[model samples]
Target: MLFTKGGDGKVIPRCRIKPLSAKNVVVEGRDIDVQTFLKVYRQRVHGLRFIFDKNVRRRSDLASEFEGRIVLTLKIASSGEVENVQIKLTTIAENSPFSAINEDVKESVSHWKFPKTKNGATFSFPISFYMMLPQPSMFDDSSSIKNK
Candidate 1:
């Protein structure tokens, strides 16, 4: 069904619901309607947040002084498993750091869980995470010399 906005910006329901016949009846009840089906589907799909701590394990072999935000896009299945992970944005110091972080996120997010619905229906959803590079303390005199 298609919905469009009217002049006043209110949604105008545009779909014509045809009369249900006995052959078309999956379940015979007044409560069974298109709205009910839509509601059920909507309930199945959900968004989840991926929280990362300030201190992430860095790849020692890669360039050490890395800093910036890394945005990851993930597609999660209805069973709460990650189907795919993509790097939407990354500001790492080198390509190796980006690859390392990408591998780490893919491994971690795959085991993450999304909330389940009452009907037990599975749905796919996209999520993004922002990762910040760790910074050394400005109060430390040794670190200040290193920064210069």
Candidate 2:
């Protein structure tokens, strides 16, 4: 999801949700369809950018040593609340700093709130994290760096 800050300093979804299936409404007993569920959700959820921004620090600290991605699956209530969050995949070593980052991201996302609806929804998305060092200034030729 793309996020932009609102005038009140809240995170807002850049894109609205598209049309969704209504058949699941009857099966799930939810009043809203998938798109409606997501549209409402995207509007209310906040602090998502925080999770992505934090990755920059993680990258600087562990960039040369490791890189990783976490696939998160969330269960959202119709009331615009997060019911559950799970890490579906990760490449960080179990005891590494990236592992801690993974857990931190999951915990942060769990506390997120979505748009309320009559029925809860389940969705999966991937968040990839990595870091790199800044290159030297092009004008500084004294260091004599070779062209790769």
Candidate 3:
């Protein structure tokens, strides 16, 4: 019988037919089942990441040296464009180059390209960069000499 009585006493169709029509073709022209397509599409739309360069710098004025980490979180659009970029966290060295670091991050992130989703949906991800300044020797009399 094309329909059978289930435990719930409802008549359910035993056979379902999917037509191989051009209009029903999947994104990549593959004949994928509805459930599998949804699962893969969801994953692709949500998978996003940010990668930071290793040369980020941290600058501080008080310590007479620069030091810190630059944490950036980028929100990408479905079109694979960067919609927004925020500094998630900041670390500074006493004498590091803060302005230069900021500028560098801005320029670098602007050049990044995110992967686009199959359905043309955009996503966002967070990335971090670390920069540290070398510590001066404790026994170095440079600070005392400079103060004089």
Candidate 4:
């Protein structure tokens, strides 16, 4: 998804998600090719996101609502275990609501798994969170209707 801040009261995401470089993908011991592994790895990681929302709500560091990009670099072992997850870049600030999402993001990343390969692989991907902003009422006197 791509995002661009709009001057005319609109929000369009303009971010690009790049697949892992072929040279970075390895499947020595496994029977699958690099392309197939990449597909599977992506699917697995996206599926893991379902579990993140539930865990994130428990935290109160900040209200987790923002429209921006968060890129994460991950290293996976040959045994399908995630070795590391690092914040490559983020358009949102840490003091913002994104801080509340940090633990949930880590928790989600930890659950990502892939088939065992002869050697582990390292790659990066971006996850975008977006929502529409609330607009003010069209009429200023609308509140007077209820007051009467």
Index of the highest-TM-score prediction? 2
Candidate 2 clash pair list? 78-116, 78-117, 79-116, 80-114, 80-115, 80-116
Candidate 2 local lDDT, 1-90, one digit each (tens): 333444874333222122233332222334445566556435533344354445434444444444456666777777768788888877
- TM-score per prediction, in order, is 0.34, 0.56, 0.35, 0.52
Q: What is candidate 1's lDDT per residue for 5-65, written digit by digit as tens? A: 4477433322111222333323222323434433432343221111122122233222234
| Candidate with best lDDT | 2
Weakest 10 consecutive residues, lDDT, candidate 2? Answer: 12-21
Q: Which segments of model 4 are wrong by more than 4 Å?
A: 1-34, 41-65, 132-148
Off by over 4 Å in 1: 1-64, 93-99, 118-148
Residue-level lDDT tens digits of model 4 in 14-93: 21224455565433333335676567657754443433333333332221243456677777787877878887777766
lDDT of 4: 0.54
Candidate 3 accuracy as TM-score: 0.35
- Point out where model 3 deviates above 4 Å: 1-66, 93-96, 118-148
What is the C-alpha lDDT profile of model 3 across 1-148, one tens digit per residue? 3233448743332221122232332233223333443343234321211111122211122222323454455544555565666665556443543445555555556555545544332222222223232333432456575545
Clashing pairs in 1: none
Model 1 Cα shift for residue 126 (angstroms): 12
